[model samples]
Target: MAEELLFTVDGPKAVPARRISLAEAGLLERQHLQQWVIDHPELIGNGVKIVTFEFDRWVSGAGSAAADRLDVLGIDRTGRLVVVELKRDRAPDTVTMQAINYAAMVRRFSLDTLADVHAAYLGGSTTADEALARLMEWAEGVSDETLSPPRIVLMASDFGPTVTNTALFLYEAGIDIRLLRYQLYETAAGEKMLSVAQLLPVPDAEEFMVRPRSSSATQAASRKSGERRAAAAQRLIAHELIPDGTSLTVTMPNLVGQDRDAIRAWLDAEPDRARVRWYNDLTAPVEWEHDGQRYRLIGLIRTIIESATGKPPQAQIWPTAWYCIDDGRTLNQIADPLP
Candidate 1:
């Protein structure tokens, strides 16, 4: 794939900005780039939300390796762990091996350990309970007892053939791996800019999704999720806590990437307007106020996501993604008090 070319529009003319490197721009790996990623994780991909920044606190069970630091730890919508490794320049061939080692180490992490790290990373900006709640919310329905293999993401100015080749091989072998090439550009006014691209996966990030297996366990989980939602909806309906036609605002969780931007833009364009309404159907309780179409809570979120991202979001718990416009209570929260 061709590298991206960015142009600045001066009145009516489009002028191309000269591409530069991190070195030329005088940016440090940890101080500048890494911190930027820690602040705004979309530099990697919006799908993978940052869990903690700069995790280095690891002790080898075998006592063979020294203290190794993972640049960033994240989790996707599907509950898989994301291990991000960064380099300021062209990545050395050893980055692939290093990222693999990092993934190996984190793959064994318990959700408790993850929550602890997240709480520490929050640095008292929020309470422990709030941090844990945020972490579990991002984890979706992934329980503490279950853990999935970590996905490796390598971000750098470029990757050599060795790294790219190994990434392709790992991906083909069913290992979740992605390479993001960081490009640097300088404008005519001497201002610096940066751009990142998914090199190996190349182009769109949504195409390479983590496919869930069709096992009996997965089927059972899906069925249980459906039943849980149905019961909650029924309880809400019975209690009259959410009367029919109760206006609702779609309450999105922490979002990143282009789709998130699209949704935010649409939402900020209309803050007071409620796009969703409560209906009488137990299986499908939410109505689109604009179109008058009824849909399940998950389906409404999915529709908005599909409209924004041009595809459905990864599987996640959606009952709490929206809330009452008047009371600001979620469906699950409203159902919690019902006897």
Candidate 2:
């Protein structure tokens, strides 16, 4: 149990510490606790940033037993799927086994499936493809193929001896499982407070226990892969193919007099052209073929502006007119700018 200290000044004299009982505030209901975590997912655990929360997700077992509904499902920053199960009071003896089953069920979820979960949690405001792109952008050095297995987390007001011992045994046996205790407190003024603590693996023993699992060989291989990807990205930037703030001048002619319909038709007929829609609208970004390679209008504009001014363009909206010199013919083209 977690305790709090109360101090009162006694007319310029100091007073001894008065310990307050957090349970005096009364325990919160299970549903209410689940809602609190959904509202502030940061409270789920330390070192975890929740992507999205799925409430009461049903899971099926192999036997004839009924399906189990999970309290919350989330993905961490590194793309590892997280299964969070909450118990309002003391955790039962079989909570660890239950969590293990849940983890097993979700272990084989692909990146696309996880993205779909997030998108559905967000009420279809974004697609799974877009969510995947955003997740990749946020978690550097981690790819869809390299994500770790699903992690299981069990939260409750208190953990029983049987559950705690089982959690420790599973964790030592190489399972990514954690036990968290949520203690509620109330102040003298009728305010509620919460404290969360991670009780498994013991904080002091983490280095000795967790460090040996990430072997030196695996670390070296990961480092080499990252270096190789970085080199490739740098090469692309130098060639002005990737828009990563590198500047290069492209002296193409303006497409002021070119027929818009003709240009669109020509682009449509090109076999190498790839259709890319940044948004759902008629306005399309300029995409064209140059030197047997395809380039977007926004990339060209960014390259030109960055090269000329030594600074990235401030406006995120696409520029009105741009030039691209291809095969010694100055082609004037107009397409929707980036937003």
Candidate 3:
């Protein structure tokens, strides 16, 4: 296939903008892409949220390379890990398999580790607990247990048939992999512009693919969300992971600009879907105290998010908000640390 051309119209005079390699625009370095992605992950994929950049902390097993590095790691709204691999030009056929391998490695990353890594990425602009809270805000259901079966996103100027074919196969086989074509355009003023377009899993097809799962799967997931919250609460309190009466602080603020109408709509959607009921009453005790009030971690965050987003927390609030005043780790980190 032939490459597409781009132009800049300056008051009826159209000047051709040459499409070139990322290297030509000084964007081929790993950090160039990593930091840029860390700053603006929206450029990568839909609902993609950047977690950390330059993740390579894994120790090599028998068949793995010791120095393997993941360029950009992110997550989606659903909490699946997103492995973003950046290429300067045409993506090599091996990139897809390589990204899959990185996904396998990242599957082991704990919620705590992600928070710590994001802290380092932030260069101490904020506390790790705050970073974890923000991460939770970005990927609502993200937690140690929620991270799994990572997704892959390949970005480059073009893709050969082999890479696209492999990605298509993976997508159909239940692996969520996507291909993005990036074109680097140089304007007449020496400014560089980037165009990112989805290559595989066409948007309409993707919507069809992302439909509600089989009834069994849907029921199981809905049930799991509720059960997981209860189990985590029971395990934490019973095991004294975080002893009762601990004075916890809101690591982040409550959902400001809360929309009552959206909240009402969310509460009305999908009557049969199971969700852990939140303590709608602000006065109820949650087992953790803030200003002489007892509250459960999940319950408190749910109240906050529901007020803010008009939706049930669905484990979204647990690991993200609220931190121990003494230890500074978020509730979920203490309750569900990675093994």
Candidate 4:
């Protein structure tokens, strides 16, 4: 045979293309995608368990052959079932409706529906059915009043508007919905990588879930109101403006061990400030008044410490009395010796 050469009139020869596998094309690694739920089961909403299961793979008694073979099912701690529908390429409009059908089947039939199928298809004994029985037990544990609605976890690399809009609408109506977006990137070495990210509810949901007014903010405002209280207590200790022998209550922030020692030394050096009768850690009414002026020393200390570090330090409360006396001086007059 004569030597022959193949020729093309193209401007440049086409380079050989690398073949991408189904897992690689979808950016799914065998390990990460297969056991994804087991690794982070908490992400399956708050109360759901990622169940290892296989449904009938065919719908019967429904009188319809259009039902899809469910890929996975997750039952929550509350015994409500969550149907998970996965799409490697594109999840179209019908997927949600399809998943809902599966959910309906589970709800209508319960795990008892799987008994015959488990023996024939799964080839597992009744012992293997414990996982399914556990689901029933969990459901029975809940009282009828507190049962939550069934949920759906729609997972895919690319999701269309059909599924997205439906999921959002159902979520607003109190139905639990979780969306998992998977991304695949190909490295220069031809290895595929998969990354999973969750889409959580909107910020407004927090408002409905929480009290309209923030407790923390209310607490902060109270602290601000108490500054004058602390200052008033300081004046009561000095006996500057109060009538003699008048008893008054005062609030003082619990001093730390180190500060306590320093103040004790200062008290020994200069006995100004009224003599503290008995310091009570529990302050009844938690408010103090002296000479028609009120002092919330506990709140003031919190403000000071918080301002210093942008966070309030843990504090203890002390309720003590200040009496007008001749040689009683305030905290300013006493200073602990430098350690």
- Among residues 3 or more apart in sequence or in different chains, the pairs in candidate 4 whose N, CA or C atoms overlap within 3 Å are 229-295, 229-296, 272-328, 272-329, 273-328, 273-329
Q: List the lowest-lDDT window of 10 residues for candidate 1.
A: 205-214
The per-model lDDT (C-alpha) reads: 0.70, 0.52, 0.64, 0.44
Indicate the residue-level lDDT of 178 in model 2: 80
Candidate 4, 113-154: lDDT as tens digits: 433333343344534243333333333222222222356787
> How would you encode candidate 1's per-residue C-alpha lDDT over 1-339 as one tens digit per residue?
356899889799998999888878888999999988988888888866788877888877686665788899988755678899999898998999999999888888877677778778887665554455565455443444334577789999887767776775566555768899888899888888888888766434223334323345533553454232224565676667766887887866654323667766666666533478887665567877756888766556656656666754543344554555566766667777775
Scored by Cα lDDT, where does model 2 land? 0.52
Q: How are the candidates ranked when ordered by lDDT, highest leading?
A: 1, 3, 2, 4
What lDDT score is found at residue 98 in candidate 2? 85
**What is the TM-score (0 to 1) of candidate 3?**
0.60
What TM-score do all the candidates reach, one by one?
0.60, 0.53, 0.60, 0.42
Clashes of 4: 6
Candidate 1 residues lying further than 4 Å off, grouped into runs, are 62-65, 125-127, 203-339
Please identify model 4 stretches exceeding 4 Å from their true place: 1-47, 52-54, 57-67, 114-129, 136-149, 186-192, 204-339
Q: How displaced is residue 71 in candidate 1, in Å?
A: 0.4
